[model samples]
Target: MNITTIGFDADDTLWHNERFYVLTQERFADLLADYTDRASLDARLQAAERRNIGHYGYGIKGFVLSMIETAVDVTDARVPAAVIRRILEIGQEMLRHPIELLPDAHKTVAAMAASRHRLVLITKGDLLDQERKLAESGLWEYFDAVEIVSEKSAAVYRRIFNRHGDGPERAMMVGNSMKSDVLPAIEAGAWAVHVPFELVWALESAPAPTGHERYRVLDGLGGLKALVDWIG
Candidate 1:
């Protein structure tokens, strides 16, 4: 492993993110408890999320819209106006929630930056929301470049590698989602380190990589510094 540049995924990888979504979903379920059961509401909301990903993309805004859509569908379009108002409130609350860094995220990132590795943040979501989180996290200064993309794919990784990095062989992506961060970086010819988060969005879940030369998995960010040191 001769990695020179390292890219990080911003959401659950670097901070507590999906937990807020889960919390809001629970609130959403409670708000519409009369319309359906928890299991049924969860399924319908997931369905709505999948359907709206193309139109709204991923973020609190999209999640809020999905909740509203699910509410309308489950209630046969009779969802109370107050419920809709509450749903909007949920979205606003999520947007306003404080950015909580995951355990060792700050230390590990600082170590990587101190080691002179070129660091880039590659995350996908609403631009304003993502920017706000980055600003609040106070880790923005560590990154040499920040990319808020519509989606994470091989092409996207390739472009980032070409522009900010020496190329795939010299680049590594560290993140939580195998589907978004690890796999695509590998597909783009870069090394990838998977740092699994306890709660992952169903949309971002995928099978772990096995026996891949450029792929490695660590229990958490605690191992990130040593891994990058070894790679360097």
Candidate 2:
């Protein structure tokens, strides 16, 4: 009940994210339909994403590269330049995609800030893209600090919470990804709140810690303020 620092994940947590990737993926499948079936193409793309996460990290840039890799693999490196260009365009479109805040995202963040809790954005993705989204969200002023990490892990959570707040013991991480946001934060001894987002990305998926003392789940961001107050 002594939580002070509240950390939030940007994508899908504050706004719509995975939908763009999924839509682009559908587009990728369409482009590769001549060379491979949807199942084969999806599997190849997912494998490419998983393998390339370390090399490319998380973002549309990496996703575009994975699509290109999948295209090349499916077509034996014979995918036309036009298709490649279109894939690049899709990535740009995603990058340019406007920020559309989730239900109650704005109000919840405002309320949290009003309560004088130190809110921080702790998310993973391309630096520029994350920054752009945060800027567009118009909620940037609420956060006392922001962290766009290349990856999320227990150590990363520990370091971020320690630097931004009173350490992980008094920090709370809130996000849709159990893998990236909830689990690691809890492992770092921080309270973690899971707010499930639609179209959960494969890499961010993990089993929920249903009974962890510091773990809580909300059906939506609207419940966040009350949850924090109740915790206090």
Candidate 3:
């Protein structure tokens, strides 16, 4: 476990994120309740989100667009313009929301930085929005480097580790998403730690690594110090 560098995912990994999205989705469901049931509306929104990922990628803007699309689809293009405006307002509110760091997120990252770990933030989303969140989170100074990618894949992890640190074998990734954070890092030959969030995006959800030698799941960020110590 000779890890020389560590990568972190943004969004739910370091700060409160999914909860806001869930709240917005609940509002969206209510707005469309006249057209369909909550479950059906949710399903349709998810389908729209999935369909729009390639076009919009992942972020609040994409989400708003998907919600509007879902609203129109469900209502047979009869959704009011005011309702569409409300959906846009929802996305704007999310963009303006305060950054709330997860429990021990700052302390853990600070500790790791103090311990001389080369910390890198590897996140995927709209660059401007991710940049805004990073700046607002106040955890920016701790990271030696920051990567705002359109997506996370094994090749991307491998390239990042190779360029920023020693190599994949000596690198680790920590995040909540098994799909974007852990699996890709593991596939790139790096160690990964899963810090599960209470609410995860459906697109980012995946089964946990069961018996992988280089994978570990922590209940929360507070356990990161112990894991790093054990690795050392």
The 0-to-1 C-alpha lDDT of every candidate, in the order given, reads 0.92, 0.92, 0.93
* Cα error, candidate 3, residue 103 (Å): 0.5
Query: Clashing residue pairs in candidate 2, if any?
Result: none
Better of 1 and 2 by lDDT: 1
lDDT, candidate 2, residue 113? Answer: 96
What is the Å distance of residue 96 in model 1 from its true position?
0.2
lDDT by residue (171-227, candidate 1, tens digit) is 999999999999999999999999999998899989877999889999999898888
Position 114, candidate 2: lDDT: 96
Query: Each model's TM-score, in the order given?
Result: 0.98, 0.98, 0.98
Task: Please give, for residues 46-134, the per-residue lDDT of candidate 3 as tens digits.
Answer: 99999999999989999999999999999999999999999999899999999999999999999999999899999988899999999
Cα displacement (angstroms), candidate 1, residue 57, comes to 0.6
Clash count of each predicted structure: 0, 0, 0
> Candidate 2 on 72-180: residue-level lDDT in tens?
9999989999999999999999999999999999999999999999999998989999999999999999999999999999999999888988999999999999999
Q: What alpha-carbon RMSD in Å does predicted model 1 have with respect to the real structure?
A: 0.9
C-alpha root-mean-square deviation, candidate 3: 0.9
Total clashes in model 3, counting residue pairs 3 or more apart in sequence or in different chains = 0
